[model samples]
Target chain A: MKLYDLELSGNCYKVRLFAALAKIDLEIVPVDFLDGAHKREPVISLNPWGELPVLVDGEVILRDSQAILVYLARRYAGQAWWPEGAAQQGEVMQWLSVASNEVQHGPNAVRLVDKFGYEIDKPQAMRLTDRILGLLESHLSSHDWLALGRPTIADMAVFPYVALCHEGGVDLSPYQALDQWFNRIKGLDHYISMPGL
Target chain B: MKLYDLELSGNCYKVRLFAALAKIDLEIVPVDFLDGAHKREPVISLNPWGELPVLVDGEVILRDSQAILVYLARRYAGQAWWPEGAAQQGEVMQWLSVASNEVQHGPNAVRLVDKFGYEIDKPQAMRLTDRILGLLESHLSSHDWLALGRPTIADMAVFPYVALCHEGGVDLSPYQALDQWFNRIKGLDHYISMPGL
Candidate 1:
């Protein structure tokens, strides 16, 4: 299995972190993101979106980090990471949607602006970050995991960006519950760290 | 099954469209968006996000439309709409992430601005819309569907927003391939139409 990786990207980190915890062997093929290699040839051929963290296992080529997590969890990690049954899967997927949308727009956008010098509305990004973090803090205040009362792909999908919120210039001091949740995920067996985390 | 729906929301319509095609019996409970019903009470209790298109089936309560589609497809429509196995599910999920992120930020944001007078950067929304639509057009130029070479939840997840791009002031005339793909989805068995379509 090969993963098109970027060391600093939280999206890429999500897959790497999951692969480590799940004990799945993956060949990390670093993309020359700074030189726009992802936007060019071979990468574009694999994903029309031209995004990093593309996972190629045999005939399966997945682009989105959330989707890659889904594939990895379902195929290799068994039902522990991504549970079966429609309801539980849907519950886990709700967080994946949040990870893709709210988490991406909020913490991820801010990170791009602060870390990578991307032109984005910083104020709006911070607002969105606070909004999502506030929700996470509230949810984590009473629960240990994002879905199904267990650590599923929901945590894997949302963990990276939220843990890297500081790099995005978003303060995590107010989110005590979220802070503890982050630590809990960090303590997981075989957990790996990315640049910011 | 009960679906918390808003007639004009593309997110809600995605579920409705999928349920109609899949022939799942869903009781549509219209949320009074104008009266702030979605943001209040029972809705918030079901989903902390307080977003519409919440599906309540027995013990399950799903908040996101993409997640709801997953639940409905897996539970009722079998593997045809969502597909099984690792790679096929990931292929379908890649577009679900797109629907949650790019489509939500692009065409959905523009529509919120133009139709509902929401405060959002129209230029940014249009740029995002153009970027995604251009990619979709290029992909559809060769393949008949977004994933699996068949009409899966990938098509349903992205269909509503792209089809409603005109409401967001996005002209779809230039993308001949995208138009054909949209028409093909429209011609699917048991397909239903929303307000914009």
Candidate 2:
């Protein structure tokens, strides 16, 4: 499998983190975001949205890091990462949506503005970041993982951006349970880390 | 199964629309959005996020309409709605993320502002709406459905908000393919509609 990746993006890190934990081999194909390679041929051909972390696994090509995680987990990792049961999948899926929605709009958006200088609504991003962090803190107070009582793609999906909140100039020191959850994730076997995380 | 819904919420309508199409029975518990019922007890207890479209099926309770659709399709419906294969699931999931992220931030955010007077960035919302609509138009021009060459939860997840974009003052007449896709979804077996669609 070939993963079109960017080193600094939390979205791309989600795939790399999951692959490391799952022991899946991927030929990392780095796209030049600064040079606008992602918006050009090959990358844009694979994904018209011109995003990074596009996975090309033989006949299957996927955009969206969360979708790519689901594909990789179900295809190579096993049921442990992306369970088969309905309720289990639903439980895991709630976090995946959060990863795409709240996390993206919150910490990730703020990071895009602060670190990459992308024009975005910083106030709105900060507001969403506060709300999502509060929710995660509340949930992590009782549970060690995001869903299914064990580490799954749910954690993988939401981990990178939340862990890298400082890159967005948002403080994570206040969230004790969230901090511990981060430690647990970092302690996982074969775990990988990306820049700014 | 019970769906905590608001008749005007596109997110809630996603679950209700899918249930109707799949012929799944749901006890629609209308939440008073205008009266702030969703933020009160019972509803808030079930989903701390206090979002509409909370699905309670016996022991399982879920928030987020996309996750609720996944649970319903995999459990009550069949592989026809939510496929079992890895590639298939990933294919459908790409659109599901689009529903939660792009569609939510774009059309839904605009609707929230225009219809309910939400204090959101309308210019940003309009920009995102145009981009997502263009992408959808391009995709729908080539394929009849969002994924698997058939109607799946991918379409269900994205349809409500896109269809209701007009409520946000988005003129949809230019995109013939998207209009056609809308009709296709409207023509589905046991299809249901909400206000402003």
Candidate 3:
């Protein structure tokens, strides 16, 4: 499988991190994001969204990190990461929606503004960040993992931007449970790291 | 099954519309959104996000309309709505992310500001709306459905807000393909409608 990747992108890292954790071999084809390569020929053709981390597995081509995680987990990683049961999938899926929506608008958006010079509403991003971090702290304070009582793709999907929150000038120190949860993920076998993480 | 719904909410309508099309019974418990009932007990207890369309199917409770759709399609509606294959799920999952993120930020946010008196960035929402609509129109111009060569939850997840875009001051007349797609969805076996749609 070929993964059009960018090492600095937390979205791409979501896919890369999960692939590493699951010990799935991926041919990482790094995109020159700074030079606008993502909006160019190959990348844009594969995914018209002009986004990074597009996956191509023979006849199948997919975009969105969460979707790629679902594809990889179901096809290669077994039912452990993405379960078969309906309720179980729903439990994990709620977090996936959070990863795509809240986490993207919150920590990820803030980081885009601060670290990458993207023109975004910093105040609004911070407000979203604060709310999501509080929710994460409250949830992680009681539960060890995001879903299935184990480390699934749910954790991987929400982990990158949050771990890189410091890059956005958001402090992780106040979130004790979040800190501990990060450590737990770092302690997992085959765990990988990106630059800001 | 119980659906804690707000009649005017597109998020809630996503679930209700799916249930109607799939012939799944749901006890629609209307929440008083104008009176702040969603932020209070019962709804808040089920989904700490204080969001509408909280589903309670026996012991399994779920938040996020996309997740709810997945649960319903997987459990009750069968594989036709949500396929079992990895690539198929990923294809549908991409649109689910779009529903939760882009569509929510675009048409939904615009409507929240225009119709519900919400404080939001209308310019930013319009920019997002333009981009997503262009993409949707382009995609739908060729394919009849969102994924798997047939109508799936991907179409359901994205339909409500886009259908109600006029309330947000969005002009949908230019997007002929989207109009046709809307008609296609409305032509489904047991189609249902809500207030604005």
Candidate 4:
């Protein structure tokens, strides 16, 4: 399996981190993100959206980090990572939407603005970050994992950007339960780290 | 099953539309969205996010429109709406992420700005709408559906906002393939319409 990757991207790190935990051998092909290589030629052909972290497994080429996590967990990691049944999968999927929407617009957007100099509203990003963190803290206060009382792709999907919220100038010190949840993920077997974390 | 619904929300309409297509009897408990009811006691108690279209079936209370779609499809509509196997689910999920991210920020964001008088960057929303619509047009040019060669939750998840793009003052007349895809969805059995559509 080949993953088109970027060193600092939380989205790319999501796929990489999950692969490590599941012990899947994945070849990382670094994209020249600084030179806009992702927007041109081969990478763009693989995913017209020109996004990072495109996974090519034989004929199955997938984009979006959350979607790739679903693919990896379901195809290789048995029911532990993603699980079976409607309610459980739906539970896992809620966090994936949060990852793509709340987490993306919050910490991820702020990180892009501060760390990478992307133009966006920093105040709005910070506000969203605080709001989502509060939600996560409340949820984690009663539950150990995001879904199914175990480590699932729900945890994997929402972990990266939230873990790296400091890079966006958002403090994690107040969210103790959320911080504990982050530590739990970090303590898992075969846990991996990206640049910010 | 009960759906905590708002009449104008595309996300809520997604569940309503899908339930109609699947022949599932859903009770619509209308939320007073205009009066900030969703952010208050009982509604906020159900979903910490306080978002509309919360599905309550027995002990399972699912939030997020995309997640609700997964739950309803897997439980009620069988594998046709969600499908089985990793590749097919992953294919469907790719567009789910697009719905949560691209569609949410693109057409949906613009619609909120124009139709509801929300404060947001109109130019940025239009640009995103154009970009995503272009991608959708290219994909729909040869394929009848968004994923797995048939109607799936992928189409349902993405259909509402795109169909309502005109409410955002974004023109869709130029994207013929995308328009055709919208018409195809409109012609589906038991398909229902929301306010903008």
Question: Which predicted model would earn the best DockQ?
Answer: 2
Task: Compute the lDDT of residue B104 as modeled in candidate 4.
Answer: 94
> A3-63 in candidate 4: lDDT tens per residue?
9999899999999999999999999999999999999989999998899989999999999
Q: How many steric overlaps are in each model, in order? A: 0, 0, 0, 0
- Note the residue pairs that clash in candidate 3: none
Writing each residue's lDDT as its tens digit, candidate 1 over A83-197 gives: 7788888989999999999999999999999889988777878888889998999989999999988788899999999999899788789888998999999999999998778
> Order of all candidates by lDDT, from best down to worst?
2, 3, 4, 1
Per model, how much of the real contact set is kept?
0.80, 0.76, 0.71, 0.72
What level of docking quality does candidate 2 show? high
Q: Which stretches of candidate 1 lie over 4 Å from their true place?
A: none
> How far off is residue A55 in model 1, in Å?
1.1
Report, for every candidate in turn, its global Cα lDDT versus the true structure.
0.90, 0.94, 0.93, 0.92
Calculate model 3's interface RMSD in Å: 0.6
Least accurate 10 contiguous residues by lDDT in model 2 chain A: A188-197
Model 1 C-alpha lDDT versus the unseen true structure? 0.90
Q: Write the per-residue lDDT of candidate 2 for residues A1-197, one digit (tens) a residue.
A: 89999998899999998999999999999999999999999899999999988999998999999999999999998899999999999999999999999999999998999899988889999999999999999999999999999999999999999999889999899999999999999999999888876
Residue A54 in candidate 1, Cα distance off native in Å: 1.0
Model 2 achieves a DockQ score of 0.88
lDDT tens readout by residue for model 3, B30-110: 999899898999789998888888999999999999999999999998899999999999999999999988999898888
Please tell me what DockQ candidate 3 reaches: 0.85
- Give TM-scores for every candidate, taking all chains together and pairing residue i with residue i: 0.98, 0.99, 0.99, 0.98
